[model samples]
Target: MTDRQITTTLTSPEDTCALAARLGPLLRAGDVILLTGGIGAGKTHFARCLIRSVLLEDEDIPSPTFTLVQVYDTRQGELWHSDLYRLSGPDDCVELGLTDAFETAICLVEWPDKLQDLTPETALWLGFDAGPQDDARNLTLTWHTPRWDTVLKGLVA
Candidate 1:
């Protein structure tokens, strides 16, 4: 299937959170989201929003930077939030159970460049950038598989 991409400018953190909340319900097992952005680009915030939305609660979602990975149990299944920034190589990902989670859980991966070729081909890629406004952010969502086409379309709609 052809790849699909959508870009949007979020003026505030609430806008970003709302976007994540809308997308969260559309996600399912075996879905992988690769988040790419520089520090303070709001990747973690976006992830937390998504996770909390899926859980349908105001849970405290923590960044996985220091701990590497955090797993959350939801009614739908397991959701994995992983930060690969601290890993030295892709092999470390296997040791951390990322490979397995990528196949079975809804994975939100930050700094996925650390995964190199190990990154899944079917993953949805999100690239965030600082917007013109100080508190705004530009988000680009790239879908590599047709599996996410409808959901992506709905998100932009």
Candidate 2:
């Protein structure tokens, strides 16, 4: 797997949404995204933007914090959003059906550390950090999949 880092700052929720909008077009059905960050790091906010943009709809996309997972169907395919913060362990992954999701849909997982050995090897990782102050946020994206490299190039362009 190849490791690369991309650091960028987002000023507001709109800015975060804009970045997600730019990246959303590159996602495919089998893509997986692992989001890592502390509380208030804007992981869910970024994901909401991503899925909504991909669906081309301006609907309310709530964080699946308690429900654990949410699915959206777009013309491209299914988009699955999962928040595993409340998971007991990797054993819970099968219950969530993540392995199958990896092959059938585009997945965005928050609190990815909960699934130690279950996250797809080709999954793209997006790490978030709180900015200096206010509502600012810093995000770093990395991926090992060849498809991700192509997407990264488009994002960087």
Candidate 3:
């Protein structure tokens, strides 16, 4: 893990989507992205953009709020989008196959705080907060693994 962090201001949903598009190609199996944000904070929107970028197509990405997890097959590999808001504890994630997916798939996790001990130490954490202006969001990306250094550089480029 490195003490590297990137912060950006997204003025609109398009900016968030653009960031996701840039990040999508750098992801791979076994990578975990923990998304932290309050309700209506654009986490799902960002996930949708990332999934579409990875698939190289415009696909309907429904929120995993109720289902807990949504799996998508892509040319790169399997991508798992998970919303842990409904989970009661970290153990509950095991039953949802999140534990297995964390090892085999590219995981985009919403409400990742619920995972507690199950959370991967190498996971990239993206914290979202409301910006000063309406419709703006402040995104703080914290990198916890050396593998993300090049990817983060590319994103800045």
Best by TM-score: 1
Candidate with better TM-score, 1 vs 3: 1
> lDDT per residue, candidate 1, 8-68, as tens digits?
8998999999999898989999999999999999999999999998884457788999999
Q: Per-residue lDDT for 1-157 in model 3, tens only?
A: 4568988899899888999988898899999999999999889999999999888455789999999999998666999999999889998999899989999999999999889999998898998999878889999988777878877885853
Clashes of 3: 0
The per-residue C-alpha lDDT of model 2 at residue 80 equals 90
Q: Which residues of candidate 3, in runs, are more than 4 Å off? A: none
Against the true structure, candidate 2 has what lDDT?
Answer: 0.85
Report, for every candidate in turn, its global Cα lDDT versus the true structure. 0.90, 0.85, 0.89
Off by over 4 Å in 1: 56-58
Give the per-residue lDDT of model 2 (tens digit) for 4-86.
77788887778888988888878888899999989988899889888988884557788899989998886679999999999
TM-score rank order: 1, 3, 2
Q: Cα deviation of 45 in candidate 1 (Å)?
A: 0.3
